[model samples]
Target: MKKHTYILASLLLVSGIALAQKENIKRANKLFKMKAYTQAAKTYETKERTQEVLQNLADSYYYNTSLQKAIETYRELFVKYGDSIDIEYHFRFAQALKGVKNYKEADEHLSKYYNKPVNTLEFIEANNKITPHNFKLKEIVNEGSSSDFGLSFYGENKVVFASTRNTENPSYAWNELPYLDLYTATLTNSNTLINVQPFPEAINTSLHESNAVFTKDGKTMYFNRTNSTRKKTDEARIAHIKIYKAELINGEWTNVTALPFTSNSYSTEHPALSKDEKTLYFASDMPGTFGSFDIYKVAINDDGTYGEPENLGETINTKHREQFPFISEFNVLYFSSIGHQGYGGLDVFRSNMVNGGFDKPVNLGNIINSNLDDFAYVIKEKDNVGYVSSNRTGYDRIFSFSREENPLTKYLVEGVVQDKNSKKLLPGALVEIINQSNKTIKDTVVGENGYYVFKLEPNKLYKIRGTRQAYIEQELEFLTGNYGKSHNIDINLESLVSVEERIHQNEKGELHVQLDKIYFNYNTSEITNEAAKTLDVLVDLMKKYPSMKVEIAAHTDARGSEQYNLNLSKQRAALVLEYLVNQGINKNRLKSVGYGETRPLNKCIKEGICDDEEYDINRRCEFTILK
Candidate 1:
C-alpha cells in the first residue's frame, strides 16, 4: 500500500509540473500578442522545446532584430518540425539568413517560400544602380546616450529628436531601454549635434515619447506619448501610444492633450503634419488596420477639431508593418515597410501622390537600406539632404545624408519610330540601344504610340537603332554627357525596296537581293566575283545598322536531286553569312537557311518544263530582317 501511494504522489507531481508549464506558455503567448517580444522571449526560453514554443521563441527573436538567435532557433524548428511548419516560417527563416548575408542559404528557403527562384545578390547589385542616392553615414555622438532616433527639423538651425539617454526614467520592457523623451539640440554645419537637452516636463513624461513634428512657426508641435495606464485587451495588457498636441506659449509648452481618435486599446504614433499644417499623418494598428500597423491621415479643421482618421489604404499598407510616415513639402509620402520586398528588415519607400491618390511605393534601395531596421526617414527637398534612423549598428543611431541623383538613372533617351517618307508612327518597329562596347543594353518593340525609352548612364556613348520588316535599319549615335537630363532622338526607317527598285519582299516577308544571273563553276558553292560585289551592298547595310538581325536564305533551281540541291543551297547560304560576318557584322546577327528546290519562284516546277531564263528566277539569295 505504501509503495502504491508513493507512485500515485509521483504521478500527481508530474501532472502539476506539466500544468504549470502550460500556464507559463499561455502567459508568454499573451505577451507576444501584445508586442512585448522581449518579455515573451524570456518566458518562452524557459519552456520545453516543443514546436509551438520554439516557433514563438524564434519569432520573438526575429521581431526584436536578434537575427543570429532567430536563425539558430529557426534551424532547430525546421529540423524537428520541417513538414508541419507553415510556409510563412520559411520566409522568416530566409530573412534571418539574409540578415547575416548568407544569401546562398537564404535563397534556398526563399525559393521554397515564394515558390519561385529568388536571387538576393543579383537584386542587390541591380538595385544599387537604380537607387537614387549614396549615403555617407555619421553616427551622432551623444554622451550617455544609449539609443536615439526620429530626428526632425525644429527651427532654422535647430533639431528635435527622441532619445532614451536618461537613466532616471523607467526601463521599458520591450528592449530594456529607458522610456523615450523628446530632446533638442543644435545641428551644426558638419551634421553634428551639440547642447543636447530634454524637453520640458510637460512634453517629456514618465512614459515613452517620440516622433515630434513642428509647424513652420515652431510654436505648435505634435508628438507621440504612451498612455500612462495599461489597458487590458482580449489577449494582453497594452500601454498604447497616442499623439499629443502642445503649443509653445510664453516660452513654455502647455495645453497637452491627446488627439480625438486615439484609443486606449490601440496605438497611434509617428505623427507628421503637412506643410500647410492642415493634414495630420500618423501610424496606427486600430480596428480597420489591414495588418499589424498602417499609415493613416486625418484633416485638421480650422476649428482645431479633426475629421475622421483615414487609412492610407492598400497602396501604402500591406499585410505587414508599414509605419514611420513622413510627408515632404512636395507632397511625397515617405514611409518604412517590412511587408514589401526588401533586403531584409524595414526598408524606406517613397510614393508620390498622383491624380490625388498615392501611387505605387518605390523602395529607397540598398544604399539607404540595410539588412536591419531602417526607419524614421525625414528629408528636406530644398537642401537635398535628409536624416534617417537605423539600428543596423546594433543600437538605434541617427544618420545624416546628402542625396544626389543616381548617375545610372540620371540620363535617359526616349524617341518615337516613324516611317521616313510617310512621317507616320510605325508601330511594332524594333528599337535597340547599344553601348560603346558594342553591347545591346536594351531592346524593345515599339507599342501603338511608336515610342521607346532607355535609362542610360552619364558620360557614355550609345547607339539607338530602329528597324522593321522590309525596312532599311537606321541608327543614331549620341553621347550622354549631361547627367540628370533627358534626350530625344526620333528615328525614321526607310523601306529597303523603295531605296532600290530591284530589292523586293516576297509573300513570306523575305527581302530578295535580285541580281543578273552569272555563271558559277557547274556546282561549286564558292562566292563568285559578281556575287561578292552584290553581297558588299548587304555588308555595308548591315554595318550601317549595328543592331540589325538578318537571315541569309539561298534557293536552288529544280534541276538536281532534292538532297543534292539541299546540300548545295545550305553551303551557298552559309557562304553569304560568312561574308557578312567577315565584313564586321556580328555573327549573332546573321542566320543561314536553305530552301533548296522546294519553294520554286513562279510556276517553274520540273527541270524540263521551264526554260533556262525561267529556271534562273528560282535560283536566288534573300535577306530578311529578323529583328
Candidate 2:
C-alpha cells in the first residue's frame, strides 16, 4: 500500500509540472496577442522566445521608467545568449539600471563593453562629494488632492497648481473628461497650507491646467491646458495642448493667448521663464526627440510674442524623460529626469546656462530622491531652498530642501601673471597647477593684461597653472580649506628662458632674495635660453652680496613624477650654480640643492585637481640668512 501511495504522489508531481508548463504557454500566447509582454515575460520561459520577450518587456517597462524589471529580463537573456550576445542590449540594460539609479550594477554591466566607463564610480564619487545642497521641508504648498502639482509662486502669498479634486456637478463635464482646474493657495511664514481656491475663467476652463510659471514681474502667467480624454480621442478633432499666457490685470489674469509652434499634434506644458524673463522653456512630445519627453526653448519677442520653439538639445534633454524645467534669475536651470542616476524615481537636476546655452544637467542626488516620483521641482532665489511635489506620503505633496548659500558655494582664486622684467601683462599664456599626486590641478588662459581667475571648492588642495604658446608654463600650488574666505594671488610669471630676483638684507646681514618669476615647460628638464637671462640676474644678485651664501631651491607644482621633479630641480640648481660661477661669483657663495618639489611654499595636494588660483608660491629660489 505504501509503495502504491508513493507512485501516486510521483504521478501528481509530474502532472503539476506539465500543467504549469501548459498554463505558462497559454498565458504567454494570450499576453503576446494583447501586447503585454512586460507582464507575461516570466511566464514564457522558453529559449526560442526569451530574447524576443525580453526585448518586448524592456520596451514595455521602459515607457514607465521601470528599469528594475527591464534589467532583470535583459540579464537573463544576456546570460543565456553568452559571450556572443550583442552588447547593445547590455548598454540599454545598463541605461535602464541607471534610470532606476542602480549605478553600481549599471556600471558593472556597462564597464564590460569599454575600457573606460563614462559614468564610473570614480566620476560619481568625485561629483557626489561637492554636489550642492542642504535641504529641509519648507511647507506643504498644496494638499487634499491627488493632482496638486507644478506649484509656482506668482504673487506674494499666492501659489498656483493643477488639481483634479472633484468640482460641482456641471451640465455634463466639459469635453467629457475629469476636469483639471487651476487652484491657488496662500502661504504663511509658518508654511501653513490654507485658503486654497480655484482660479476662475481667467486661467482654468475645465481643461487641464497642470503647470503655471510667471514672468519676473508676475504680470503674465504661462500654464498648460489639455482637454484630455480617458482613452484616445478623435484623431483630427482631439483638442491639442498649448501654453497660454494671460496678463495679470489689477490682481486678476486677463487676455489669455496661446504661445505658438508649441502645439503640433502633441502636448506642450511645464513652462519656466528665463532669469531675464526674456525666454520660455518647457517640455514637449512632438517630433525630433532623443527620448520620450524633451525640453524645448522658445525665445520671447521683445513685444512679448514668442519666436519658434527650439529643443534644449542633448545637454539637458537626455534619451530619457526630461521634464519640468525651472529657470532662475541667475541663469541656473533645474529640471527633473530619470535619465540621470539618483537615489530613486524621477530626480531634480541643475545646470547653468552658459553663454546663452544650457550646460549639461547635473543630478541633484540622494538627499532629494525617494522610491516614489519626485518631479515638478522649483527653487526661488530669495528662498535658496528647493521645492517639489512628491508622493512620499502616498499622496502628491509639496516638499522642500536647502543647503548653504545657493546650495553650494564654490571658492574663487583671483590673480594676475606678469613679466618681472618689463612688468608687462602676459596675455594668452597657459597655466598648469598640480595637486598632491603631482598631477595638474588647474589650468587657465591668462587674459590680456595677465589677469586670470580660477574657481574651486574649499577644503581641497590645488595647483594653479598658466602658460602661453611661446613662454614656458608657470605652476603654483596652494591649499583652500574649510573657510568662507578667498585668496588673492599674483604671479610675476617670468619667461622660462630667464629668472628675476629682488634682494634685501636680512637680520644676520645675509641676502634675502625674492624670485619673482621662473617658468618651465610641461613635464620637462630642459632650460630655455631665456632662462639664462634670469639666472644672470641671480648671479648679479650674488655678486652684489658676495658675503651671502644661498641655496638654489627648485620646486614644482603638485603634478608630474615626484622623483623626476626632484631630479629636475637638482639639475636646475646645478645650472643656476654654474651660471653664477660663470658670472665670477665664487662657487662657495651659491649652494646648489634640488628640493625636488619638496618644501612647497603652497599647500597643494592631490592630482588632476582643477582648483585655487592662489597656489603660485610653489616654484621659486630664496636665500636664507646663511653664510
Candidate 3:
C-alpha cells in the first residue's frame, strides 16, 4: 500500500509540472496574439521546439527585424516540420533570408511561395542602372530617441516627425517602445534636430500619433491617431488608426477631428497633402483594398469637406502592404511597398503621374532602400533633397538625403521621329543606336507619339539611325560627356519620293525602285553592260540610304519550261543580291526571290499566251523596299 502511495505521488508531481508548462504556453500565445513579440519570443525561447512554438518564435524575430535569429529559427522549423509547415512560412523565410543578403536562398523559397521564378538580384542590378537619382544619405542625430521616423517638412525651416521618445507614455506592445507622439523641431544645416518639442497635449495624446503633414501656409495639419482601445476583429484585436485634422487658428491648434471616411474597423493613416492642398493622400486598409494596406487619395473640397476616398489603383497598390505615400511638388507619387519586387521588407518606390494617372512604380534602388522596412519618403523636387525613414539599423531612424541625377540614367539620347518636309510625327519608325564598334547597342520602334529614347554610356560615340519603309534613312552621330549629360537627336527622315523621282508607289502601296530596262543574255542569269549601269544607279541610292532593306525579285516569261524558268529566275535574283552586296551594301539588307511565270505583268500564264512584248514585260527584275 505504501509503494502504491509513492507511485501516485510521483504521478501527481509530473501532472502538475505538465499543467504548468501548458499554462505558460497558453500565456505566451496570448502575448503573441497581442503583438507583444519581444516578450512572447522570450517565453517561447524557454519552451519546447514544437511546431507552433517554433513558428511563433520565428515570426516574432522576423517582425522585430532580428533577421539572423529569425533565419536560424525558421530553418529549424522547416527542418523539423517541413511537411506540415504552411506555405506562408516560405515567404517569411525568404524575406528573412533576403534581410541578410542571402538572395540566392531567398529566391528558392520565394519561387515556391509565388509559384514562379523570382530573380531579385537581377532586379536590383537593373534598378541601379535606370533609377533616376543617386542619394547621399546622412543619419539624423537624435541623442535620446531609439526609434523615430516619418519626418516631414513643416513650413520653411521646421520639421515634424513621429518619435517614441515620450517615455512617460505607456509602452507599445509591438516593440515595447513608448507610444509615439508628434514632435516638431528646427532642422540644423548639419541635419541635427534642435529645440525639439512635442506638440500640445491636444495633438500628442497618450495614443500613437504619427505621419504628420501640414499645408504650405502651416495653418492646417493632417496626422494619424491610433485608436485608444483595441477592437476585436476576425483576425485579431486591432487598434485601427484614423487621420485627424488639426487647425492652427490664432497661433493655437484646435478643432481637431477625425476624417469622416476613417473608420474604427479599418485603418487610415499616413496623411500627405498635395502642393495645392486640394488633395489629401493617405494609406488605408479599408474596404476594397487590394492588399493589407493601399494608398488612397481624397479631394479636399473648398467647403472644408472631403470627397469619397479613392484607391490609388493596382499600379500603386499590390496584394501586400503599400503605405507611407508622399507627393512631391512635381506630382510624383513616392510610396513604400512589399508586394512589388523589392529587396525584402517594404522598399521605397516612386511612380510618376502620366496622363493624370500614376504609372507603374519603380524601386528606389539599394542606396536609400535596404532589406528592412524603409518608408515615409518626402522630398523637395526643386532642391533635390529629401528625408526618408528606414529600419536597417535595427530601429527606425530618419535619414536626410541629397540626390543627384543617376549617372547611369544621364548618358542617354531621346527625341522624336518626324517627316522632314511636313514635320509630322513619324510613328512606327525604327530607331537604332550603334556604338563606336559599329555594333547596334539598342533599338526601338517609335510609338504613336513618335518618341524614341535609348540609354547610352559616357565618353562614347553613338550614331542614331532612323528608318521607315520607303523613307530616306537619317543618321546622326553624337558624343556623350561625363557628369550626367543627355542629348536630343531629333531625326527628320525624308521620303524616297522626295529624294528620288524614279521611286514610285505602286497600286498595292509597295515602293518600287523603277530603273531603265536591262537586256540579259538569252536563258542566262548574267548581268549585261546595260544592266550594270542600271544596277549602279540602284547601288548609289542604297548607299545614300543605308537603312533601306530591299527585296530583289526576278520574273520569267512563260515560254520556257516552268521548272527551268523558275531555276533561271532564282539564279538571276541571287546574282542581283550578290551584285548589291559587292557594291558595299550589307548582304543582310537584301533578299532575293524568283516568281517564274507565277506573277506576270500581263495575263500571259502559259506558253504562246501573248506576244513577245507582253512576255518581255514579265521577264524583268523588280526592287521593292521591304523596310
Candidate 4:
C-alpha cells in the first residue's frame, strides 16, 4: 500500500508541473499576440525550448532591436529545427547578423533564403559611390537627459523635440525608458540647444507625446499624444496613440483637440505638414494599413475640415513597419522602413512624387543610416542641412547633419571608340576598365555612336582598354584625382591587315608575320642582322597597341631528323621571345612556341622531298595575336 501511494504522489506532481507549463505558454502567446514583446519574451524564457517558444522568443528580441539576443535565439532555433523552419527565419537571422557586422555569415543565410547571391560589403561600397549626399552628424546634447529624439524646426530660431528626461514619469515596458514629453529649446547659431522646457499642462499630460510639426506662421501645430485611458483591442488592453491639433491664442497654445480620424482602437502618430499647410501627413497603424504602420496624407480644407486619409500605396509601404513620414518642400517623401533591403534595422528612404504617385523608394545609404533604428528625418532643401534621430548609441539621440553632394556622383569618364586610320566611330567595340590590381572593374560595348561612359571613384589609378575582332587593341592609363570632373578620351584601334601586307592568314586561319626568310645561320638559332630588322616591325606594332597579347611560333623545313628540327626551332623561338622582352615589352604578354617540321607550309614530309627555297619558306617566325 505504501509503494502504491508513493507512485500516485509522483504521478500527481508530474501532472501539476505539466499543467502549469501549459498555462504559462498560453499566457505568453496571449501577450505576444497583443504586441507586448518584452513581457512575452520573459514569459517564454521560463517555458520549455519547444519550436514554437523558440521562434517567438527570437522574434520578440528582433522586434525590440535586441540583435545580440535575437541572433543567439535564432541560432538555437536553426540548430534544433532547421529543416522544419520557415524561410523567413533565415531572412531574420541574416538581418541580425548584419546588425552585428557579420556580413560573411549574413550573406550565407541571405543567399540561401533568397536563392540569389547577396553581398553586403559590395552593396555598401556601390551605395557609397552613388548616394547623392554625405552627412556630418553631431549629437545634440541635453545635460542630465538619457534619451531624446524627434527634433523639428519650431520657428526661425527655435526647435521642438521629444525627450524621456523626466524620471518621475512611468517607465515604458518595451525599453524601460520613461514616458516621452514635448520640449522646446532655443537654437543657437552654433547649432546648440538651450533653455530647454516642457510644454504647458495641456500639451504635456502624464502620457507619451512626441513627433510635433508646426506651420510656417507658428500659429498652428500638430503632434502625437497617447491616450490617457486604456482600452481593449484584439484581446489586449492598450493605450493607442492619436494626433492632436493646437492653436496659439493670446501667446499661449490652447484649444488642443484630437484629430477626427483618430480612434481608441488604432494608432495615428508622427504628424507632418506641407509647406502651404494644405496637406497633413502622418503615420498610422489604423484599419486598412498594409502593415504595422504606413504613411498617410489628408487634405486640410479651407473650412477647417479634413478629407479622407489616403494611404501612400504599395510603392512606399510594405508588409512591415513604415513610419515617421516627412514631406520636404520639394514634395519628396522621406520615411523609415524595416521591410526594404537596407544595411539593417530601420533605414531612411526617399521617394519622389511622379505623375501624382510616389515612385520606388531609394535607401539613404550608410552615411545617414546605421544598423539600428534611424527615423524622424527632417530637412531644409535650400540650406542642405537636416536633423535625424537614431538609437545607434544605445539610446535615442538627435543628430544634425550638413549635407554635401557625393564627389563620386559627379566624377565620370566618357569616351568614343574610333578607327585609327579612317577616324570613324568603331561601333560594337569592347571597352574595359581595369584597376591597378589587374582586376576588371567594368566592361561595356560601345553603342551606335561608339560612345561609352562610366562613373569613376576619386584617387584611383585605372587602365581603359578598347578592342575589336579585326583591330589591334589599345589601352590608356589614367587617374581620377580631380573629382567632379569629366574626362573625354577617344580610343583609336588600328587594323592589323591594313598595317602590313605580309600579315596574311595561313591555311590554319592563323595570322602570321610572313616576313622575308628570318635567316637562322645554317644549323644555329642565332638571329642575323636582316632577321633583326624584320622583328622590329613586330615590336613597333606591339608598342602602338599596348593591350596586344601575342605568341611567337617558329617552324623548320622538313630537311633534318624530326627530333633535331624540333630542338632547333624551339631554340629559335626562345631567342626571338628574349629579344622582345629586352625591348621593354611585358614578359607576361608574350609566349614562344616551336612547331618544328610538324606544321610545314607545303606537303614536304621527308628529308629530300623539298628544294632549298621551298624549305626556306617553312623556316620562319610567325606572330599570332592571342588577345
Best by the TM-score measure: 3
lDDT of 1 by residue, 1-627 (tens): 999999999999999999999999999999887787899999999999999999999999997889999999999999999999999999889989888889899889989987999898888877776565666666666666879999999988889999999889998877888989999999877677899999999999899999999999988899999998889977778899999999999999999999999989889999999888999999999999996899999999999999999999999999789999999987889999978778888899988665566877877887678888899999998788889999899989998887876766568889899988989898999999886657676899999999998877666678898888778778789998655689999999888778876567788777765655533344678888898888788777677656668888888888879999899889889988888788888899989998888888678877688888788888877776665
- Name the candidate, 1 or 3, with the larger lDDT value: 3
User: What is the Cα-based TM-score of model 3?
Assistant: 0.68
Total backbone clashes of candidate 2, pairs 3 or more residues apart or in separate chains: 36
Clashes of each: 0, 36, 0, 0
Alpha-carbon RMSD of each model:
21.2, 20.7, 18.1, 23.5
lDDT of 3 by residue, 1-627 (tens): 999999999999999999999999988888888789999999999999999999999999999898999999999999999999999899899999999999999999999999999999998988887678889999999877999999999988899999999899999988899999999999899789999999999899999999999988899999999987787855467788999999999999999999999888889999999889899999999999995899999999999999999998998998789999999997899999988999889999998765568877888889889988999999999999989999999899999999988867668689999999999999999999986657676999999999988766556667889988878878888888763577788999998888899899988879998899765566888998889889999899888777778899998888889999999899999998898889899999999998877898779889877887877888889999887
Roughly what TM-score does model 1 have, to 2 decimal places?
0.65
Per-model TM-score, in order, reads 0.65, 0.53, 0.68, 0.64
- lDDT values, one for every candidate: 0.86, 0.67, 0.89, 0.86
Residues 1-627 of candidate 4: C-alpha lDDT, one tens digit per residue? 999999999999999999999999988987887668899999999889999999999998987888999999999999999999999899889888888889899889989987999998898887776566788988876776888999999988889999999899897766667899999998766777899999998898889999999989999989999998767756667888999999999989999999999999889999999878899999999889886798999999999999999998999988778999999997889999987778887899988665567877878888789988899999997899989999888788898988987776666889899999999998989999986667676999988899999877555678998998658878899987555678888999987778867677668756666666676765789988898888888888778767778898888888878999999999999999999888888899899998888998787767887688777778888888776
Put down candidate 2 lDDT per residue, 1-627, tens digits, no spaces.
999999999999999988987777666655544445445554554624555566655655553355666677777777776566676666677766766667788787767755466564565555565565546655464555654567787666687777667555131222222467777787666676579888877677756677888776888888887644432333213455777888989877899887767564777878998877788889887789787788888888898677878988888887778888888766688888766655445778888655567666666655565644678888776667656887556455776556553224456678888776777887866666665556665677776877777666566677776654323345667888543457877776554234423655446544455654666555555666777677777676556544546777666666767888788778777876776688798887778778866776655753465353433456555544344
Best by lDDT: 3
Error of 1 at 216 (Å): 0.5
Shift of residue 478 alpha carbon in model 4, Å:
29
